[model samples]
Target: MEQQQIKLVVLDMAGTTVADQHEVEACFAKAARMSGLEASDEAILAAQGLSKRYVFQLFWRAQLGESHPDVETQVDKSYAIFKEVLEAHYQTQPVFPTDGCLKLFSYLKQNNIKIALTTGFYRVVTDIILGRLGWLEGLDENRIGNDDSIIQASIASDEVEHGRPAPLMIQKAMRLLGVTDPKHVINAGDTPSDLQSGNAAGVLLNLGVTNGTHTVEQLIGHPHDALIGSIDEIINLIEGIKQGRPSGKTADAYSF
Candidate 1:
């Protein structure tokens, strides 16, 4: 629980460190409509933090019931549309870091903690967003840079065999960062699957931010060490840990 014991912090992209205004969810709905998949927005939003392809697959199965002759085709079409829509949005729209995201990064860097971004997005779109925010500047080919780099590392859902609600992405981030112990990592995200993923990874701390896709009531249904309204509160938790306080260990809710 000590500050020095924390070696890395794994973050979710769209809703955690990036200000997502339901854009991704909206795109998913569009893709579903375009592909003739019957899915409600609530269903798509509930699947947030899950790999987009998997989301489509789930929806296709639900829509078609069991197996259908054209299930794969429909899923593929929806997924393709989703990728195109999301890619174009990030490529054309103005992108900015979430509130206090940069300051949290600075604080982590100053404390010698590694920062890694994990997302349900594919590598292509991930790069586009990172590039727009100028967070991909110093990253190397492996996408795993040092603390001095824009971000220590970035892991996309495609890079891992499984996405959120599974530990693969978090495990991949830890491996790439050269951090061996899950007990020394913290996972902070904005969705239920994010918390489930962190819990499956057995991280030292699993936190949630309510300012993103899900509300506090939704996030509390998942297992998390703490919940906050903004990323800026991370600084306060780290500072508390530095002072020998069991700050983030308590399952309290924080909203600003």
Candidate 2:
């Protein structure tokens, strides 16, 4: 197989690129409780990279049978509350970039590789975080690509037809970045859904970062090129991928 040069890199937001102190879980828990659902942290953690609306629907359907008339309404109600709580948490909280994330972003920019942020967050919440960080400058109204901007693209879960575990976000990013071949893309995140989407899209490499919401044990057995540490570890992996080196996996460390 011919190795295609990488053109775009798609990354998850909260736990992957942004420092998450389980604030998302705390907000989600508050919303779940107010809506009469006693969801555990493990459950919420497991659904880390999924759409919040979808997560509510899943839990509601699990509690109330799928055919029950109250499922959709409860999902809507729960999601509305989640958005309120989530928005407030992010608004008041200290939001910062994850370790080595800025350096990696600069590396990609200097190499002429497009950087896109895809998050399970809806657009409003996504903007709150980006606006605070001043990372929203280059995105168009639709959050599409702009080469002159620090980030070439910003994709919110609500912007796509489907969220993680589905390839739509990654595919949409590729389209906006003008990257037709998945072989020319790289996808990285801290959750299994992130890996699945990248694998589903047939990207050049799908990576997992343990320093996020999940641990190495939690991320193992997923179809990923390797499980790494910080976001910046990707710099070496990108070089290896571009040079036709298939970075292999190892235990507990950055195997890529």
Candidate 3:
């Protein structure tokens, strides 16, 4: 069977392209503790690629039950704390891109493949990280810029009604980039929700990288066309596809 050409690549931020350093998870845990909510580490990890506010809402409901009267207030409080912590950390702490991220981006650009960054972060924080990494060097407020920009577009969770596990963000990226066929795109991230979103979008390739939040063992059970330890391996995956090799709906590939 011939494989469809991949015209675009949608990437998840934080754990995928950017080194997460467990900072997001740590902030979530700290917010839960400060808010007097009980959430296990696994519970937090499971929602890795979800919206921040939505994650807080889920935690609140899980802790106090869905019908709890103070669920809204608790969610608000926890989310606010989380935002403060996260924003402050990103503002002060150093920002670093994941290994092989720059090389992968350059290769995709050279191949004339469009790149879109989709994240669970809000626009403000997303801009902060992008600016710090110089990814936004040539980007303006519109976010759609020339080849000088590292990425062609950016789609944030809050921009869509529903975030990861919903496929809305990926769909939005496709719409903005003028890509009509989902089969012509590749969605890559480091969390289960990322794979779920890509699958829901019916993309040709749904890739998972272990260098982020989840490890190889943690991501094996999720739906994915390939699994690698670094984003750099994507270069070869696309090359294989262009050579008429199967890049999807087969055994997962682990190339670290």
Candidate 4:
């Protein structure tokens, strides 16, 4: 029997494929305060990988009743501020790929593995970040890229009915990329939510990166196939899968 081969790699944007220097947190902190809600850095950090709008709503609903009269108002106001701040930050600040990001892309290209980026960000900011990185170069008006392009496709949280921890984005990505089997896809991100979504999708490998928003200690106890040290380490794991043997020499390659 022929061994199953990976055909798609779905990656998260902020902190996973893109270098984040607390820029997102700065924006979120501003929005959190602007909404007249108090959220600590720890709270905000824990909310990473979730839809931005959902995060605000979550915080607001937590503070107030789910049906509070002011919930929608606060969500709207603070999200607007977040958009302004985030757009300004990305427009003025430089954006770059994370460590080994290009290397992984090149490897996937060489092997014909489709790449899709899923984000907690909405479409406007997602386009901003992707455009800044020139990853949106060849995509059509539909925002569908391809392996021949920098990326194949991108799914923003707002595009789907549900976001991370729901598998909607991953399922949408698989549908968009023409992939049928979760056993042939690898989902990777920098947050526990990423793992949960991948698990929900039942992908071949649900992976996490420690070099991003979450540390090894933070990601432990999360259901995942592996929690690697960096994005580059995935090359090793994939190679092992291809070779039918895993040396597993890289520390933390599959820890929790």
Q: What is the lDDT of candidate 4?
A: 0.87
Off by over 4 Å in 2: 247-256
TM-score of 3: 0.94
TM-score to true structure, per model? 0.95, 0.94, 0.94, 0.95
Q: Mark the 10 consecutive residues where model 2 has the least summed lDDT.
A: 247-256
Cα lDDT of all candidates, in order?
Answer: 0.87, 0.87, 0.87, 0.87
How much does each candidate deviate from the true structure in C-alpha RMSD? 1.8, 2.0, 2.0, 1.9
lDDT of 2 at 218: 88
Give the range of the ten consecutive residues with the poorest summed lDDT in model 1.
247-256
Residues 106-210, model 1: lDDT tens digits:
889888989999999999999999999989978998898876786899999999888889999999989888899897788899999999999999987789889
Q: Residue 220 of candidate 1: its Cα lDDT?
A: 89
lDDT of 2 at 244: 60
The 10 consecutive residues of candidate 3 with the worst lDDT sum are: 247-256
Which regions in candidate 3 have their CA more than 4 angstroms from the true location? 1-3, 248-256
Candidate 1: the clashing residue pairs are none
lDDT of 1: 0.87
Error of 3 at 129 (Å): 0.7
Please identify which of the two predictions, 1 or 3, would achieve the higher TM-score against the true structure. 1
